[model samples]
Target chain A: MFRTILLLILLVALSYGFWLSPDFKEISAGVAIFLFGMFSLEEGFKSFSGGTLERVLQKSTDKTYKSIGFGILSTTIMQSSSLVSVLTISFLGAGLIGLGQGIGIIFGANIGTTTGAWLVAGLGLKVNIASYAMPMLVFGVILIFQKQKSIKGIGYILAGLGFLFLGIAYMKSGFEAFKASIDLASFAVVGLKGLFIFTGIGIFATVVMQSSHATLVLIITALSSGQISYENALALAIGANIGTTIAAIIGAMGSNIVGKQLAGAHLIFNGITGLIAISSISYLMMGVDYISIYLGIADDDYSLKLALFHTIFNLIGVIVMIPFISKMVVFLEYILKDKVTSNRGFDSAKYLNDSVLELSSTAISSILKETKHLYDNVFEIIAHGINTKRQNIISDKSIDETIKDKYSKEKVDIDEFYNHKIKGIYGEIIEFSTKAQSTTISNEDIERLYSLKLACRGMVEAVKDTKHLQKNLIKYSNSTNRHIQKEYNLIRQGIAELLRSIYIISRTKEEDVVLLLLSKSKVNMEKYDILSNGTLDRLIRADSISDEMATSLMNDSSYAYDISKNLISTAEVIFGDVENLGMAMSKEDIDLILDKKDN
Target chain B: MGIKKFIKRAKEILGLEDEKKESKKKSLKRLLKKLIKRKREICTMLKDKKSKELQEELDIVSLQIKKGKKILHELYKSN
Candidate 1:
């Protein structure tokens, strides 16, 4: 609704401008074309981020200075701070990077954006760039029609540059024509009053345009053409700095608390930077003059001086605020505490949110992390349900000896356990997956999501199977009949052992070792089957156990096998890196393992 | 006629006389035929498949057909 209102107002303003002057229409069209180029440029950069960008970002953000360098380099190359900020927020939302790391990136982006001002001041005004734009557009349009991804990406990059140059050319001519009719510099206020007013105009224009680069270009072009004074342009630059935080704030709106906190940091940093610039304008102007004189800049070279002033003040802000990063993180955390859901006993999702749906990678990441959280809880519940400690199952102890110990009947309540631990997260994952599938996700990603949901279901089913097996397990653990008790103990031992192996596999980084261990477990699974081993038949034939006891043992053993199977299957999907192993325990491989065991 | 008799009569009408002469081979051939037919049906259904359920079913049936064909090939070699 807010966007719609803003659009309507913009439409009204543009319509009125078109009626007043044809020159205004040309300028407005130039701005529109320029913004479209920004969009295309962002798209072109995004096409290359399949894994390399994410990997580079993850590896580079380990330290404060490193993160800042990464931020500067990425924004300089991408040439769009808004894109950088959104990517940083999405990474923060997915818990891929720390809040401090995110803030460092934002600060570096501030300095990185000064490069754009230099480019426009140093070259854009002096060069006849439109002559270069024609061939670029022609070649770009030709390449855009090709089928490959990289070709299309390069096409967008070339076209975006072409449009940017053309837009600048058009805007320059239109502004020159407008100046002939009426000088905009005549309306410029002087001193402190003029500073605040122009700063406000700068903020409004950046917020409306959502690009500080665009605003800087406009200011530089106007300053060069003598339509705006250098001092007022300085104030406008400060406002543009503050206004760019709106993109970060808007990006964080659909994110979790961490994303919002990073946005808060952005606003505070930019807000403080703008205030400092406005207050220390006179002092900074003296410094700029000294630097300008030292660099041999002429008195009439306001555009170059403005670019230097922009760089210096941003450097000052980073220097001033760098020491207080830890404190800022603490303050933001204290203010933006995670909201606890009232009366809910279990923890809910911290990362999954509707805003992340804008990017497929972030959405998949958030869900993957949430599913990990679910699995952690499920692992604990499974341990407890089996009447063994979680540590013991994952430890080096023999499970055959471990199941000999008796557990209290009071602990394993499947219904209450399901309600508290598994059901809510399971439902949320299924719902989230269904919603994700509706988006324009790739088929491979959709299949991955489906497999994840199935893994969750497998976990829940394993718990249910354990619930059925638990009664017989506890009952026969203390049974007087040695044969019946021994059979039940074998069943318990088998499941506990399977859980231990899976637990071990889950913790190990060696994929080859894990794959071999999983295949061996499938081979060993057949050994525990009482029917295949003839244990039940041998005991009944000898009349060592009652028929009722034998029947109970048979049924309980099947449940045990099922619980292990489902749990192993779930583990394979969730943690085992099944794809690298070429499908989880194919039947042929299992048969081969069986044959080896037999041999 | 009863359903079993009707099936037998249909087989006879379809000129499956050689199948009756060797019951073991006949059963193996019938299974192979059934599996191949199911595979063809799955392939057709999968062309414009919309649901994951259908995809999963197709995968299972395809696996089953592959295994069945392997077994049928082994039986032919033995004969």
Candidate 2:
């Protein structure tokens, strides 16, 4: 009820300013200052709230409506929808939140964003808010320089004041420019063409500024400047609401199904509301005008009407859409059907939001997720390499054709990209994770990140070994020497066993399952050792195997053992105590042990 | 004088002395011994891989061997 009355008051003030205000620039400036203040206040509040906001987000795992409510409350406090959306994506990627839950959160984010718009609209009517901005700025600077945590609150207060005035100043300038135009009133009609034009203007403006709040401030400025009527301003406000969905859409494009779905729900909510608002523009204008007259505000006061329209439209949209969330989800699923199966490949960019970096714990979690994806990619490449080798041995024509025609090129591309491109990305994540670790991250998060980094490094080393083995196998296959072929086959068998152990360890989450696989890998190492010793003994006896063949076999054996050891060590890091795992040994040790055995 | 110099060069290239032969054999044995030590190293590495230790270690013998192989290839190419 209070919200409705507040909406009505803002609408009347807006209408009066548009119709009767002699100083259009001042009115617009006032609105801008209010918006800037609201934005700064929200940012200040977010820093003050810190982990509490994240904790609130973590508790939002209930149904969609609850999640949306949580999203609204959190984003409202944080004051940035971009931060909210990026955080939501990170959470979704981490499997902390479901698709439906994320959708609700995003929906809530849209609503939360309107708090800034409303604050601007309400405060735009005031004549003397700018007087307070300077003192706030001064106090904020003092707080910033105080070097004490308690004093930072003063800085936030000052920043909020400064931003409010700055916002007002720009808004005033825009309105003055608009009002000074000779034919401003000629553009005030609120028909279908007007609606489309205003909507397009809103979306384009929001996209340009990358902030819906900025676009809303501009709309208010134009309304208060007498450049647009209340009806046209309302149309533009509705458009701004829809335009805000663009950020989430761009965010979802490169992300997974859950991200796309969450983004889709945001679009569906806004798109539907946009359609409804456009259709009911005449009625909504009548409603705005009727309320304005009741409050004794003239039709020319466009700023107040625009703010009221913005708030009422979103509130009504939420009320209407809240009941049909499941339907909306289904609709969004249909609309973004292409995202369901198309493997656009994983994007870790969602975790790269600068806002999240300010919060160390969330940033650490994001880094860990990216590192996990990197490890998965490495495992995929190695598995595919093994598959290629197996297909070669069986001489499967279809397999050979697939490898040569399709996967061979892909393998090279992946190798080049992984080795050259992703190494830096992974390294940056590690570096960031390390820095973030010094901040306020939990012990468990730190351990997870550390373990994940080890796993990624191991996988990278394993891929390098696989690449070398691939080159050696190619050479051995082409040589056509029977003795070399036998040695190659033996070495390949050992490598196959090693890969199998890695595959098993990766697939199972149970510690015992990994431990069992590690034991098997150990047994395989012993077999490899016996094979190495036999080959060396044959070489010493001057058997049929050439010296080159003996050397190649030894190299291959050593390589396979090293790769297997790296993989098993990675699994142990994930499952066992990090301290119990002995330090890594060198390749020369394998040869030395074999020589000692021979003696 | 030219013939003597040529003969000396040939002897050096061929490693003709008994002492040189013994030393070559000893070096070969040492290389083989180092290569054989890889068995234990392989086992240890496999253990670490299974356990998944995260620390970065430099100057590792296997890594050195891998490095040595690259240097040897470069020398072979230049020759």
Candidate 3:
């Protein structure tokens, strides 16, 4: 029904223009060139600022207001909201930013994108911008050929300018052609029919181009050429706002739960705003006229009015919705409910959604979430390793029997299938963290990333140590020597204490609790030393302990001490500062015991 | 002599009429004794042993021992 109405208006307008204006062909050609130039400019800016922009977006802080500010600033700088939305989806998928933060950034992004509309409107009203556009294109082409990095950057900026002008030129030319046609002119002047027709035109154009800035330029050109009135242009601007939200929704479809919620919020924000603007058409037209008269661009040029209406609609939307942001968030959550069977594995690349990278705020927050998941997974694995006792560390005989008797051989292919399944998840997290860090993140974000990376490394090291301890325990169990058994038991207790301390420190977030645990770990280390030294002295006096057993016992004691020391240091790094490392080591001072042995 | 003869005749009647049954049963019992001798050996190498030409032979022996144990337990229950 909407399409049928829109087509009738275009047909009437085309017929009227055919009988009216002269030099319409020249004008159409100019508008085409202008539009081409604008597209080139937008593309060039994207190429020049892609990686650094993505990095900053991935490291967004938790503050909601800060994310909103970042969204606006970044979109304004990049001149595209689609990019911002895609980046948001990526971050949400990676679990870097919460749904609320993503929504705020998207909202800010919408406002930032209007800067382009205003720029186009201002340029359209003035003396020919095409005159400047040609030179930019020429210089841009030359710079594109240059090999130097700085030259390339300049080339990109020039190309962008050239494209911007070209887009404007094309828009101007198209409107002129339409204006000259008598049929088009008469159709455009058909009052209420014309208003709905142009509004539909604006929505279709913006949706097709995936850019509100481009659509606004076309509307300004049509109005300036006298093909449409100020009132119809305002209606079109309203429709354009609704069309812009489509890009965000498309970007969120491939993302996870949080991303879908953000996309839903974007739609609601734009939809409500569009509804209000459309319903108050007369008021909007009055405001646009007032701005046009004040700006002295009211004469045939409707560009000023277009720019004013765009700004007014956006500003009103922000003001009306700002207080109800929490409600909007809840509504979005209700719409995009969490999937029941979603995979929980960490994926860093998902945070780098190609679309959201254009919008830096959402991208940064997504990256932060991915890093947190990586840290948590590594911590969980380490805790599991520490808790697994020696008896259970050996492959359980009952499980093996069950596998052999009941399950198929294919199901028990341990090396080919089981190991890969477990390690693949870890590999993905590491890969993502590496990629995220490679981007130009802020110092604070870098600190957080570094902390997570280090925590993962510490956990991995702890697991390796535990495996080594398990191997030694198996060896001792096999050897029937009573002395070896006794030594193994003693070392096992010390190692168990060390593992407990590491697990406690890793799980804790509170500084005071971590400090208390570190002190207790130090006390355990002191007891370990006293027991080890006493056992060594007795062996030396009796000459009963074998050289191999003594060596093994010594290695075990040293490992215990090293592990304890590493755990304490890890805790200190996490909690920040510790008083002393050797506070309670006087009981079996290893150096004094060694000196007595030498004597 | 009388009880032993009766048991041997019963074993022959229940599909153990082959000449290798007595030697297979003896070797199977020895393997079981070795396995139960220590926990470490049972944990590490119960399913990890290997042989080149005699690998199939070892498998057959192991299976035979498992079957013999099951049959002996059934016989004891009946008695």
A100-216 per-residue lDDT for model 2 (tens digits): 777778778877877766566667435544566677787777665654332454477567767666666556565666566543668666678887887887786565455677677
Candidate 3 lDDT: 0.57
Reference-based lDDT, residue A107, model 3: 76
TM-score of each: 0.83, 0.50, 0.60
* DockQ per candidate: 0.01, 0.01, 0.00
Instruction: Output the lDDT of residue B1, model 2.
Output: 57
Where is model 2 more than 4 Å wrong at Cα? A1-63, A82-102, A117-162, A165-210, A215-236, A243-268, A281-309, A322-457, A464-557, A569-599, B1-79
Candidate ranking (DockQ, best to worst):
1, 2, 3
The candidate that wins on TM-score is 1
lDDT for every model?
A: 0.77, 0.61, 0.57
Worst 10 residues of 2 chain A by lDDT: A577-586
Candidate order, TM-score descending: 1, 3, 2
Q: What is the DockQ of candidate 1?
A: 0.01
Note the clash tally of each candidate: 0, 49, 60
**Model 1 Cα lDDT, one tens digit per residue, A313-402:** 988998899998889999999999877768467656666776556556667887888877887777777777777777777767777556
What tens-digit string does per-residue lDDT give for candidate 3 at A1-599? Answer: 87588678866765665445444544544544545554555555544333455455656636766677778887787676766666666566555567777877887887887777777777545668778878987888887676543345557668777767766776676666655544344545345676677667777767766677667777777777777666777777877878777755655666666667877788889998887787777787787677777877655556666777787888788778877878887787776676554445322233433333333333344444443344344333332333323332223343223222312211122222213333544455466556666664444446655655564455445445544544455466345877776666555445545445545566665433344455445545554563454876687468766777677666656654655555554445443322221112233433333343346
